[model samples]
Target: MIPSRSDWTKALEIRHGKSLNEKFSKSTVAICGLGGLGSNIAISLARAGIGKLILIDFDIVDITNLHRQQYKANQVGEQKTTALSNNLREIAPYISLEIKNTKIDEDNLEELLLGADIVCEAVDVAETKAMIANEVLTHMPDKYLVAASGMAGIGSPNEIITRKITKKLYISGDGVSDVKNSIGLVSPRVMICAAHQALTVLRIIAEEFDL
Candidate 1:
């Protein structure tokens, strides 16, 4: 059976204190991609007891994604947001999950970020990433967007650093590698970038740092 509310309260009190739990449990986060970095970051946030998650991805899992994505080999043909939402629910049954099986574009960008406390951009394409950033900056000025770039191959994971672009936009990762690199990706570097993105989400949720 699932743990009771009191049980969760006791656990939080002993581990993170009431204020932190309250802050995290009430925040809603939207992850704009369910690729290598996004898959891991969404799961981490769900497990951390974020109240709600909005997962948006317009792609299906492919065999190539197995190297770094959190999904299993059997999930190759599944929709990315659907697969990720199922996995996150299995890990944290108490958290609410919303899956949007469509790409974030100019049309729906503002609507998608309307109520999100924080938005994470883990999409790999440069044009799409820039679009999301521009949309958030132009329309949703109050929300925070944690974006990731340069998580390809075995580059220096230590190079991943969070930089603030404005009062509401923050980016993390190497900021150098391009998708054209032939080296391919492994789990360690991807996980490091995902962790950085997750931490940025947590910081936004906790109100410890803005942007």
Candidate 2:
């Protein structure tokens, strides 16, 4: 069951301290995909006390996604936005969430995600991923973006690293790995990339905001 507001606050205070808890509760994040990387990154941000989330995706959960994505067997056919919101609300009951159950394209990009404190590009297709990353990084220069290049298969944990692509865009992953017949997406490596993205968000919004 989800904990009470006071109970949740106490837990977050213990982990992130009092000041960070306040800032996190006021921040907003937009996740452009709802796959392995996006799901995990959104959850991390929720747990860290982010106040609002803008979740966008057009895909539904599939059995194949179980290995790496954050959905259950019962949610096999549910929309990714619905499934993720259900899970996130259960964890962070008080978190405010906005869901866009649609596919992101160049035409709707700006309208879909505007005024977000941070944006994450976690789509699977290379073309869509690149498109969103470049658009957000170049157009929304003031906003921070976290993009993942590669996180397929069980390889060296150290291989996944966060690279700063620009002043506001950061890429996290091995940078070369791809999903193929020989290698598949695993939770460990995917989470590593997501971790870097999540932590970097915290660093920018909270840690360095005062600097």
Candidate 3:
């Protein structure tokens, strides 16, 4: 049986302290792109008791995604938004989720991420990443954005670092590695960047800023 909400939050309170856990439990985070980086970031945030997650991804899970993404073999043909939401519910049953199984572009970006306190960019294409970052930073001035840049290849995990770009924008990853120029993405390196993004969101909620 699923645990009661109080019992569920009690555990997070112990690990995160009551005040921090309350903040986490009240935050809404939007994750764009449910690929390796996005999938990993969603899992981390959900596990941390983030109140709601807005998951946006237009792609379906493929066999190629099994290597690094958080989907199973049976979910190969399933839509990423649905699959990831299913998985997250199993981990954090009480966590609210808003899923959009459609591509996120300048046109519908704002509406999709309307209530998010923070947005995470995990798209694969460089152009798409730039567009989302620009849109969020330019249009959604009030929301915090955590974007990744260079978690590709088998680079040193330490190279995956988070940088504060502005008051509301933070970037994670090596800022150098690219799949087209490198040996493609490795699971560990991708996850490192995602963790940085997830932690950055938490820190933002906790009123911690990087100087």
- lDDT of each candidate versus the true structure: 0.84, 0.87, 0.92
Report the number of the highest-TM-score candidate: 3
Which structure is stronger by lDDT: 1 or 2?
Answer: 2
Count of backbone clashes, every candidate in sequence: 0, 0, 0
Best by lDDT: 3
lDDT of 1 by residue, 61-156 (tens): 999888888898888899998888788877777788877888789999888776798999988788999999888878787888899878777777
Q: Give me candidate 2's TM-score against the actual structure.
A: 0.94
Clashing pairs in 3: none
Report clash pairs, candidate 1: none
The 10 consecutive residues of candidate 2 with the worst lDDT sum are 202-211
- Lowest lDDT block of 10, candidate 3: 151-160
Writing each residue's lDDT as its tens digit, candidate 3 over 70-130 gives 9999999999999999999999999999989898888999998999999999998878888
lDDT of 2 by residue, 80-126 (tens): 99999999998789999999999999999988888688898888898
For candidate 2, give the lDDT of residue 43.
90
RMSD of each: 1.7, 2.1, 0.9
lDDT of 1 at 39: 93
